[model samples]
Target: MAEVDVGKPLPAITSEAKPFWEAAAQNKLVMQRCRDCQAYVWTPRPACYECGSERLEWQELSGKGQVYSFTVIRQVVGRAASMAFEKEIPYVIAWIDLDEGPRMISNVVGCPVEDVKLGMTVSVVFEQQSPEVWLPKFKPLVS
Candidate 1:
């Protein structure tokens, strides 16, 4: 696979999400957990999705999941946002359901697009785009 170039858009590091990204840079997957209801809040929100509590803590998770859904992007949409993937055309983007019960959208790497199947088990692999940014991608788990 060709290397994706620099200048691709990256997520803004806010105070609420800094820890999550920092952990990724260190090759660890972390998520926000609600202290009140024991719920794993996704997307790193300021308040818990289940209990509406401001008490949330960062917890590392086993980056393993199954593909809940997926699509093969055969073409780039010809927009600035999609330009980042111009060189990576015909890639598999998937919604993965982690073992911890939260879903994350990521690219399915290290395999052919046609091989990606629903409910296929996957494991996380970090791709460091820059010095501080590490994007979490997944690949099919070896049996």
Candidate 2:
């Protein structure tokens, strides 16, 4: 039921979060939408943020978004990130505002941090961390 870092002390997977992780394994992004207010929400709860209604369901998104904000990690500073962290140290991590109206934290890969900017168009790509798990990553949308 766990993906990424099977035996390691990290990559802890939980029951409440299993579905989201499972869906991501299929290269899909899932976010709960409030059935009452039709508002997109994150953290996967059974209620609406706008109307406080308990009617919610998970929906798949296009996985396209704009970078709201980001940081270029120039150093690993720890070993838990990855064994190749040194090589991939300088990476961009960002909060992306999905077209569905929810913002989620994720990493922006396949590009240099210097080129990353706020409001940059991006689309999703999946990296298989395990046979049953794929992490959703993003790349700049080329015009």
Candidate 3:
């Protein structure tokens, strides 16, 4: 990917998050699953949130979901984000409910915040900062 901004604060890409970011680069989503209970979870934990088992693996997920709850940010907290998105004031952020049951936090794009509503269908779109780095963002699913 090309660097859209010469110097911007990027989210720390940790070892545990590599797989997810790489998958996102390929337009895929993945979450952790517990080997013991077959329960799926997020945040790339060392153990299952359901069964408390350290046995886990990364599993592919369908990148389809709907907005559960959301907030429109008129004021961004960070200097870098504020600068990068100064023209894009009032963006919608939300907890999207994936079809497989995981709720992921992401920003809703391709539409105005006033148009963004609860239970609106959304799909993932990746923001590539660098060739090796990618972040998951989303857009409304339009008919």
Tens digit of per-residue lDDT, candidate 3, span 47-118: 888979999899988788999999988876667464666566688879999998889898998887899989
> What stretches of model 1 exceed 4 Å from their correct place?
1-5
Comparing candidate 1 with candidate 3, which one achieves the higher lDDT?
1
TM-score of 3: 0.87
Candidate 3, residue 105: Cα displacement in angstroms equals 0.5
Runs of candidate 3 exceeding 4 Å displacement: 77-82
Which pairs clash (backbone N, Cα, C closer than 3 Å) in model 2? none
The list of candidate 2 runs beyond 4 A from truth reads 1-11, 78-84
lDDT of 2 at 92: 88
lDDT of 1 at 65: 97
Sequence-dependent TM-score of model 2: 0.81
What would you estimate as the lDDT of candidate 2?
A: 0.80
